[model samples]
Target: SDKPNTIETDDSRLDRIEEMITNPNERIRTLENIIINQKPDILNLKIKNRVHERKFWRVSQILGRSSQTMATKVVGSYANDLKNSKIQEKHEVLVKKKRLLEGSMVTTPVPTQKAVTAFYAYMSKSENIPGTHHTLIFDTAITNENNGYHPFSGIFIAPEKGIYVFSFSIRLECHSYGPYELVKNSQVVGVVFSDIRQVCLQDQITGTMVITANKGDDIYVRTHATTSHIGLIPSDDNGRSSFAGWLILN
Candidate 1:
């Protein structure tokens, strides 16, 4: 007789499937545990990113300061180089003049005999600020006996060949310095310097010189090429700048 096959019923099959599948509550619990375990690692990653950002900014700031320092040094060096170049150029000009003198090409002016007792002129005011090598106008003439001194041009045009004595005073305002030279025929013969060291302090500097002058020779005061940007040094009621001259021989 054939053994009766064990009948596979639907209820038995369903019972086996239920055993194989996990419960929904157990799956939810497993997901929760996985998220909880990874939370600290996520927080550590965020913290590390912030630290890296801070370090990058710090390094950038340091580099910025270094670049600024380098730029300052470069600018200062360039300015110094320019100053040296000017000095060298001035030296070259002096050497050339010295060479010309050594060649005996220049002749001395003959001294004039005594003629006029004195051709005297004096001025009290500086009309305007003069530029480099520009004549300073003495607009207000106190006395011009021989009329050799011209207030409009600030020049003493020699009425006749003679030896002349010239004097000048320069007074600058507070916090100012003005250095001017006595010029004869486009040559600097003397210098007068004035400086106000303290604020609100003002003073005057004066110079005197005697020189042989040819007829129609121009004599005046002028500023140096290195004068301040203000150009003309101003004089107020605090002090006065003056110019005076007298012919010693004519």
Candidate 2:
């Protein structure tokens, strides 16, 4: 079994002293002063008439003080400096990222297989076909004005509109003086190269011409000299004109 002990206070002694004093009891004030500890130095008080409130002023004016100084002092303040810097950096980064995204969106992507196939088909359809291996010979013997030898004559017409490539080889046994030329629609397209040893006018002379022609166009190979014999078609050995190969239109 244990008994509780009580602690004594000086409140009775303090009350007795207050009763003897004529002036109002200053004990509560003194006790309050002691508890508060700090004294306001009123003699050293400064009257600050600046736009912002002082630090010692009431907290109610803090918002006003902050507002007043915000334009000038806030930029260098510790918390606001870092916060503003970070905010600006984030804004710049976001702007740069947005610009990069916009740039990427502007570029066109590679075409798909279907798109490429369609483009190729369109190009092929639009392009004209190229002509190949066309030959035309004329009968020169029909005129008979220049010796017994006949000259080559006649125009070969194209059935379809296309690019045409033609070649000719001419051989003469008796007359070396006569001239031969390959023509397209009566226009001279090519001539025999007499200077080249391989293309001399002795046994055979060959020439080539490439032209783009329309449908139903006439092309011919003609000779300057004339003869009674039709020299366009192949004759049996004696200066007879003859035509050969795939010259007939289908």
Candidate 3:
């Protein structure tokens, strides 16, 4: 009986060992099936990652192009502005130079054939009455070309279109007062004042102008309306009052 019981126990142990081996083989097969089922999901995740990477690369390329376009526009605008500024500066310089040329006082050449010159001096006390425009009559003529100056009318007519230099001087005796105007074609171009109210004996005034005159224009010296009595101080030498002019250029 002891021998039989020992053999039964040995057979049961072998059966248990075989059952353990079978269970382990079944579990390994289930694990393999699970790995096989997860392969599609892994493949789908890889595809999504690739698509995301492509989209990111495309966005980067578009942003780079946009940045370049903006930079180009900025550069172009700056260049245009700089060019316009330089042009404006040049225009201003030209305008300034033109103004300076116009205002310059350089003398110009005069033609010999059409020479216009005149000089006259007053020898007597010729009075300018009140409320009347008095034209200063110069009696003694030092030089007169073509008789352009009328001593009787105290008017000098321009013989040609040209620039001219004109000058005049007057001496006032006691109690004399006047305002003198150099008239050009009925328009006043220059003025001189002689007032001996503060002074006890006399006063003197002089006027000079550079003018542009057209042909047939009349130039003269006349007394203002408010003047009571304006006259040249009587002198034997005719040196107290004088008028002179000369042509500068055509």
For candidate 1, lDDT tens digit of each residue in 1-250? Answer: 2333334466677777786675766788899999999999999999999999999999989988998998899999999999999999999999998987876554655566544423333344444555565567666777777688787777888888878899987766566656788998878899866666456655667899999989889888878757742424555565667788888665
Model 1 Cα shift for residue 18 (angstroms): 99
lDDT of 1 at 127: 40
Per-residue C-alpha lDDT of model 2 across residues 117-203, encoded as one tens digit per residue: 000000101111112223333443232211212133334455555565555555443323334566656566666532222342334
What lDDT score belongs to each candidate, Candidate 1 first? 0.74, 0.45, 0.77
- Cα displacement (Å) at residue 194, model 3: 2.0
Please tell me which model should have the higher lDDT, number 2 or number 3: 3
Candidate that beats the other on lDDT, 1 or 3, i.e. the better one? 3
How far in Å is the alpha carbon of 208 misplaced in model 3? 0.5
Off by over 4 Å in 2: 1-153, 193-202, 225-250
* Best candidate according to lDDT: 3
Question: TM-scores of all models?
Answer: 0.47, 0.29, 0.49
Clashing pairs in 1: none
